[model samples]
Target chain A: MARVLIVEDEMLVAMLIEDVIVDLGHEVVGPAMRLETALEVVEAENVDFAILDINLAGKQSFPVADRLADLGVPFIFASGYGAAGLNERHRQAQVVQKPFAPDQIASLLERL
Target chain B: MILQNDTPNIDPFRFLGKDGEAAEIIRTYDWSSTPLGRVEEWPPCLRTSTALLLQSPVPIVMLWGEEGVMIYNDAYSVFAGSRHPALFGSNVREGWAEIVDFNDNVMKVGLAGGTLAYRDQELTLHRKGFPEQVWMDLDYSPVLDEEGKPAGVIAIVVETTERVLAERRNREEYERLQNLFSQAPTFMAMTSGPEHTFEMVNPEYQTLVGDRQVVGKTLVDAMPEIAKQGYLDLMDDVFKTGKTVRRAAERVMFARTKDAPLVERYVDFVYQPIRDERGAVVSIFTQGSDVTERVRAENHQKLLINELNHRVKNTLTSIQSIVTQTLRGVQTREEASKAITNRILALSRAHNVLTAENWDGAELRAMVVSSLEAFQVESREAIRINGPDLRVGPHAAMSIALALHELATNAAKYGALSFSDGSVDVSWQLLGDKFELDWIERDGPTVVPGDRKGFGSRLLLQVLPLELQGTATIDYRPDGVAFNFATSLEAVNDRPALEGV
Candidate 1:
C-alpha cells in the first residue's frame, strides 16, 4: 500500500479525500490543513505521493509543493483554480479541479 | 532800381522739391525771422538735404545748425499730429519740449558727425493736445556742408505704438496659457517632432511618470519601459497619421519612485496630434488620468465572485460526504433521510451564524444557541449555556456547531433531554492561553456507550479534535453523558487574512 499525504484546509473535504485515499489501499500520512503544517509534514513524512489543496485557510500551499519537489516526491494539486492558479515554475505539475470524482483520484493513484 | 527788383521774387526755397503741406509751409515761412536768416542765405548743404527729405515717403525732418530749426516732409506732418504747420521752422528742442532731454542727446550726437537710432523707444508727447504714451523708431544722421563739416541733423521718426501694444497682448495671453497648463488637474505632456521629444510636462504628468527629468528627452529614452511596452509605437502612429488615439482603463507598469519595484496601474489616456499651420503633424499632446484604484476595485469584485463560487462548490462536496457517510450508518431509507436532513440542517444553521458575521467569525454563545435550537428542548432553562463573549473563527465555529448538534441530538434521544425533567449544563472558559468547554448531562435514562463506529461518534471523537487542533472526550456515566473539549485560544480563533487569497 502506498502512503499518500493529504494537504487540504476544509475539514469535510479533507475527510472525503482521506476516505478516498484509504479506499485505494493507501496508508494516510497527514491531512495537514495549514501551509505551515503541510510544509512540516513534507519535510518529516516519508510518503510515496501527496495530494495538495491550492489554498490553506487563506494561505497558499506552494511552499509545501516546493519542499516535496526538493525531495523528489510526486504530488497533485487539488484546487478551485485548477491549473490556472499555478506559477510558471509548477505549470507542468498535475492538477485536479475542485468537486472531482473519486474515480479521478483513483485513476491518478493507479498511474503512480 | 525797378529793373534790379524785377527778378520775379526769385523762389528762394525752390530746393524743397515736393508739393506736400510741410513743404508749402516751409516755402511760405519767414525764414528771415529764424536763426538761419532767409532761405537764400541758407548754406548749400542744408538746401540740398531738405530737397532730399521732402521727396521721400518716409517721415524725415532736418534740424539746421546750432538753432536746430525743423524742415520736414508730408509723412513727417502726419506723424506730427496737431503739432504741424507751426512746427515746420521751429527749433527741435522747443517744438518737442516735453522730450527736450532726449532730443538734446540726439542733437549732440548728430551735429558732431555721429549717428543715433532708437527702436520702439517709449515717450510721452502732447501730439493731439493731451500727454499720450507712445513708442517710435527714430534714426538721425548729420548733414555735411561744402567743406565736409557737419552743418545740420537729418531725423527719421516712425511711430510703433500699435505693434508694441499687440506684442504685449500676445505675451500676456501666452503667460495665461502657461499658468493653465501647469495647474491643470489631469496629466498632460507635449512631445514634438518625429522622434517624439518631450517638450513640456505638467505637474500631474511628472507625478504619473515618477517625477523623472523627462523634458528634452525622447519618449523612448525617457521611458524605456514604456517603449518596450509598445506604447511608443502607438505614439509613432499618432505622429504619422495626425490622428487622435485613445485608450480606457489600460494596464501600465511603472515605478512611481526612482529605482522602485515596478507596480501595475491602469490609465485612461489620449494622444492627440498637434498640427502646424500648413496641416503637417508637428507634435503630440498627451492627456491622461491614473485609474489604478478603480481598476483594482473592479478586479477585486471579480475575485470575490470566483471565491464565492469555489466556496459553494466545496460546500456541495461536503454535503456529498455527509450523504455518503450517513447512508453507510443507517439500515432503512427513512432513517438515512432523517439523518441526512438533520446533518445538513445543522451545517446550515452554523452557516447562518457565520453569514451574519460575513463569515469572518462567530460568537461561541451564538454557535451554542443556534446548534441547540434544532433539538427544540421546549424550555430555555433545560439546557443552560454559560460562556464569556468569545469569538471563534469560521472554521472552528462550524466544527463546534456541528459537534454540539450531534451531542444534543444524542442527549435528546437517550441521555438528558429524553425525559422532561432532565437538564444539560454547557459552560466554557479560558485557562491561561488555553480554551476549555464542557457539556454535562444529568437526571435522565442510564447512559450506554454503544457502537464506536458511527458517523456522529467518529465526527465527535475524530473530526472535531482534528478541526479544532485540540482534544475531545465523552464519558458514558450511568446517570447521563458528559463531553469536554480543550485547545489553545489561538487555534480556535484563527481569523483569515484580511486580504483576499
Candidate 2:
C-alpha cells in the first residue's frame, strides 16, 4: 500500500477524501491546509506521494509541489478552478474537480 | 485782388465768421505772447485757410508762422482727445509734446513745401488719468504767405483707434475659442462639403485618430477603418440636411494603437450641422468620448459573477451526494431517517469549519473534535484523541466527518460507548511516507464481525479508502472493535477542481 498526502482547505471535502484513502488500504500522510504548512510537511515528513490543492487558503501551492517534485514524490492537483487556473508550470499535471466520486481519486492514486 | 489788413473795405471778422464754432473760439483766444501775436495781426493767408479749416467737417488744424501756432476747428478738438480748448492759441509743439517727433517731422516737411501723410500712426497719450491708445490717419498741407513762401501747415487728422481695437479684440477672441476647442477633454472635429472633408480637428481628436492625417482630408481618407462603420455616412447625412445625429455609444476601430492588430474602442458621440445665414448647412460638427475602459470593466464583472454562480451550484451538488450516499441500504424508515439526518449534520458541521476559514481548510484536531461532539462521545473523557497540529483540506474534512459520525454511532450501539465503563482511543502518527490513524475500542461487550455489509462497513472498507487514496481495516477482536486507517500524504493533501454546473 502506498502512503498518500491530502492538501485541501475545505474540511468536509478533506474528510470525504480521507474516508476513501482509508478504504484503499494505503497509509495516509497529511491533509495540509496552507501552502506554507504543506511545504513544511513535505520537508519534514517522509511523504511517498502527495495530493496538492492548487490553492491553499487562496494562495497557490506550486512551491510545495516543487518541493515534492524535487524529492521524487508523486502528486496530483485538485481545485474548483480547474486546469486553466493552474500555473503554467503545472497545467499538465493530474487534476480532479470538486464533487468527485471517491473512485476517481482511488484510480489516480493507484496509478501513482 | 490781394487785400491789405488796413483796407476799409476788408472785414476783420470776414474769414473767422464763416465757421460759427471756430469763429467763436479764435475770436476769444488770447494770442499775445508770441509770433502772429494777436488775431488781428495774423497774416491774411493764415486767416483765409483757418476759416476754410473751420468750415470743413473733417478734423483739421492750421498752424501759421514760425512757431506753428495752432488754430483748429470743432472736429479737430475732438480728435485731439483732451487737449482741446486750452490748445486753441497754443503752439503745436506744446499741445502734442508726446508725439513731438512726429509733429516735428511733419513741420519740417510741410514748411519746405513738401506734403506729409500718414495712415494709422499709433501713439500713446496720457490724455486722462491713464495712458490711452490712439491711431490716426494724418495729412499735412503747407499754406503759403502772400509772398508765395512756405509759411504754415494745415493738418487733417482722423482717429482710427476704436476700429483697430475692435478688430484686434475679434482676433484675440477667435484664438481663445480655438484654444478651448483643442484643450477640451472630448474629441471634436468639423467636416465640410458633401464628401465630409475634415475642415478642423482638435488635439484630442487627433490623438484618438492615432498617426492618421485627418485635417484637410475626407473622412474615409483619414480614418478609413470607420468608412464602412457608417460614421462618414452619418456626417454626410447631417451635412446634407441640417439635421443633428447623436450616437450614445458605438464600437469603432481606428487602429488607435500602432500595431498590426487593431483595437476596438467604444465611443459616445454626436454629429451636428452648422448652418449659416438663410439656414443653409455649411459644415458638420462631431464630438465624442472614449468609453472602452468602462465597458470592458463592466463585462469582466459579469463574467466573474457567472463563475461565482457556477461554484455555488457545485457546492450544492456536493451536499446532494452526501445525502444520496447516506440513504443507501438502510433497514427501517426510522433507521434511514436517523442515518441520513446524522450524516447531513456531520457534513454541515464540517462545512461550518470550512466556512470559518473561507473554505480554505480546517485543523485536523478541530475537525475530529467537532465531528464526534455530535454523539457526546468525548463527554467525561469517554473518548480520547492524540495527534499533533495537522491541517485537513475541505474535501477530506467533509468525508472524514461523516465517516467519524458513522464510527461513533457504531461504537455507541455495539462497541465501547454501549457500556458506561467502555472507552474509545483515537490517535494518529506519521509513518515513512504514510499517515496512520487508529480508532480502538475497549472494556465493552464481546465483539463479533457482522456477516452482511452495511452502509457504515461499505464506507469504511470501500468508500473511505477510495476517497483518501489509502487503506483501512476493521478487527473484530473478542474484547472490542479496532479500526486502523492509513493513506499517502499526497493523496489527502491534493486539491480538487470545481465541477461545472
Please, what is the TM-score per model?
0.76, 0.57
Cα lDDT tens digits for candidate 2, B402-497: 678878989988888898988888887777678888888888888777633466776677667756667889997677889988997665565433
In angstroms, the error of model 1 at B254 is 7.1
Model 1 residue A85 lDDT score: 73
Q: Model 1 lDDT vs. the true structure? A: 0.86
User: Each model: TM-score of chain B?
Assistant: 0.77, 0.65
- Number of clashes in model 2? 89
DockQ of each candidate, alpha-carbon based: 0.35, 0.06
Which consecutive 10 residues in model 2 chain B have the weakest lDDT in total? B492-501
Model 1's CAPRI class is acceptable
Regions of candidate 2 where Cα sits further than 4 Å from its true position: A1-112, B1-6, B12-18, B27-34, B37-52, B62-66, B97-122, B126-131, B137-154, B305-325, B328-501
For candidate 1, give fnat to 2 decimals.
0.30
